[model samples]
Target: MWNSQSIVQQQQRLAHVLAIVQDLKALSMLPLLTNLDLIQEIQTISTATRPFIPSPTNGLSLSTELF
Candidate 1:
């Protein structure tokens, strides 16, 4: 349900992030990409992203019907 303008803005942000990741892989961090310290960084990012996820308790009702 995002408006077109909002979606475009988000897409631009993702593009910039992707560029940064590409730069990391191609320019400097390529050698360290697989270092053990990366695991801790990934865990930290996951922890930060966890709270924004929506839970099933919002307002949806469940149904047992299979057909």
Candidate 2:
């Protein structure tokens, strides 16, 4: 009685093996995920914010610095 189901013994085992392979495939992308996160964190940290302060133009000039 070597039917297909009997040969495989249990379909659950096959399903489990497929699920484990899928998990391994996902683990293969771990480095890519970490790289993207590191890049985003670096960009966030290195951002420089300059406050908007109006330059004084009310009689003070750059020529005065030479004197």
Candidate 3:
């Protein structure tokens, strides 16, 4: 869990990024590629910090009961 100060800083960073996205929206009219490209870029950044996600087990888990 994030501390309050860390959460606040993250929210501030998100606001800054959202402002940038809003600014970018004005420059392009091709709707699909812009968002897709941004998503790919964010994914690349995340993959650098974390392992690639595993495939899901077709909605089944080995654990039959919650503890």
Candidate 4:
């Protein structure tokens, strides 16, 4: 007996699980992750995993200006 609300709830739960899995995947790379390499890997992962957003919207961007 699946309703639309139930389907939405399940989708939300799946999204939550996916977020956890991504974090675990990153953590699992730690032992072999060097400081510089790890930073690069994390930046790549973060950019790829994040959802797309339009300009003039509330979202983060991959800033090119290095501090």
Candidate 5:
């Protein structure tokens, strides 16, 4: 049922979410005390973004494992 344009849009969104997850992973390496708020925000963002991902098992394993 998906058209080409919608597929492209979903791919773009997946790319964006992956980038954010990467940045969050890097941020998570910092000291916990300093980055606690940021970590919480990352978790919130990760949770919010999960529904938009087309394939949870493949693309999001790292993010789910980390956060």
Candidate 6:
């Protein structure tokens, strides 16, 4: 049974981890040998943090078109 305060703290930590992962991705700083490991970590963290985030109120999908 998790309390609200603990949930908020966990969400914050997950958000921080996600930020670091995004920075690493943007800088291309990871070694080839660890790229797969990093990708797995990113997916794990994203899944963990998804519940704390709210969906868009406007009913628009988060995905965007490149074309």
TM-score of each: 0.39, 0.40, 0.40, 0.52, 0.45, 0.41
When summed lDDT is taken over every stretch of 10 residues in candidate 3, the lowest stretch is 58-67
Best by lDDT: 4
The residue-by-residue lDDT of candidate 4 on 1-67, one tens digit each, is 9999999999999999999999999788799878778667656776675643335664434544333
- Misplaced by over 4 Å in model 1 are 29-67
Cα error, candidate 6, residue 66 (Å): 37
Candidate 6: list runs displaced more than 4 Å: 29-67
What overall lDDT goes with each candidate model? 0.63, 0.58, 0.65, 0.73, 0.68, 0.65
Deviation in angstroms for 20 in model 6?
0.2
Give the residue spans of candidate 5 off by over 4 A. 32-67
RMSD from true fold, candidate 5:
13.5
Clashing pairs in 3: none
Against the true structure, candidate 4 reaches a TM-score of 0.52
The local lDDT score (0 to 100) that residue 32 gets in candidate 1 is 62
Worst 10 residues of 5 by lDDT: 58-67
Model 2 TM: 0.40
**Candidate 2, number of clashes:** 0
| Candidate 1: residue 35 lDDT (0-100) | 53
The CA-based lDDT of model 5 is what?
Answer: 0.68
Candidate 5, residues 1-67, lDDT tens digits: the string is 9999999999999999999999999878666645557656565677775533335566433144433
